[model samples]
Target: MTIEVYAMLKDYFEKQFIIKEQITDINSLKEYLSEQKPEATGILRSCRFAVDDEFVSDTYQLKENDSISIIPPSSGG
Candidate 1:
């Protein structure tokens, strides 16, 4: 199964990118993110997690071919 991963917060200062990962559950996704970008650890903790555009918590279960997005706090003047 494939999952679509999107990053929102990090895009402000870095290149925005998406990931197409073969994974089964949220835990695996977390592990994958940790490996791909260690710097995202802190942001992940505070960021809002979502599945298929619906807001969810870290423990939310992910299904096959699900779309997941991490949206970090946004600030502007």
Candidate 2:
């Protein structure tokens, strides 16, 4: 399962560039993030998750070749 993470999530990932990863499910994805980037802790609390442009939750089941994105809160005028 290749997931496409967004750059806006860099804040939680130690400022690394957005990249794709192969994982099993959302749980594994969370674990992978925590391992590769400890800064991601608690970041997913208020984040919006999407799969293939559709909004989903962390418990959402992921499929092979799925594209996922984690978007943090933002403010604008």
Candidate 3:
């Protein structure tokens, strides 16, 4: 899977990267990411996910070669 991260998550991960783990759904992906970057656990848990530009839920199923985006909440003036 190709994961594209945004916002503060960029501080921890590259703009995009590939994961070979057999992650089946958004929920599991979150868990795996949190395990990889414990410091980003809270943000990962609250972040919104998008697959191929379409927003999905935690239960959303993931497919191999899919392009996934992890968007953390942001605040601006």
Candidate 4:
């Protein structure tokens, strides 16, 4: 499935990629991402997952073509 991953910061990752393996839920997606990019694991764990603009949990079921985003905590000085 091809999931769109938008990062708040460009330095986090390559912006997006397609997953050849089946990703049934957010938890599985996270795990897959961690394996692909170990350096981002720490930051990724703290980020939030949103599917199609709606905030979702680890149990949220994902489907093909679902637009996903990795929203990190934000703060203003």
Most TM-score-accurate candidate = 3
Model 3 agreement with the true structure over 1-77: per-residue lDDT tens digits: 99999989999899999999999999999999999999999999889999999999999999998999999988889
Residue-by-residue lDDT tens digits, candidate 2, 1-77: 43444556765554324335656567667777768767665665566767888987667877766767777778789
Runs off by more than 4 Å, candidate 4: 1-9
**Residue-wise C-alpha lDDT for candidate 4, range 1-77, written one tens digit per residue:** 65555545347566676777778999998888888778778877888888878899999998977888877777789
Off by over 4 Å in 3: none
Q: Locate the minimum summed-lDDT window of 10 residues in model 2.
A: 11-20
Worst 10 residues of 3 by lDDT: 37-46
Model 2 segments beyond 4 Å from truth? 11-24
Residue pairs with colliding backbones in model 2 are none
Clashing pairs in 4: none
lDDT of 4: 0.77
**All candidates' lDDT scores?**
0.62, 0.65, 0.95, 0.77
What lDDT does model 3 reach?
0.95
Which residue runs of candidate 1 sit more than 4 Å off their true CA positions? 1-8, 11-24
Q: Considering lDDT, which of the candidate structures 1 and 3 is the better prediction for this target?
A: 3
- Which ranking of candidates, highest lDDT first? 3, 4, 2, 1
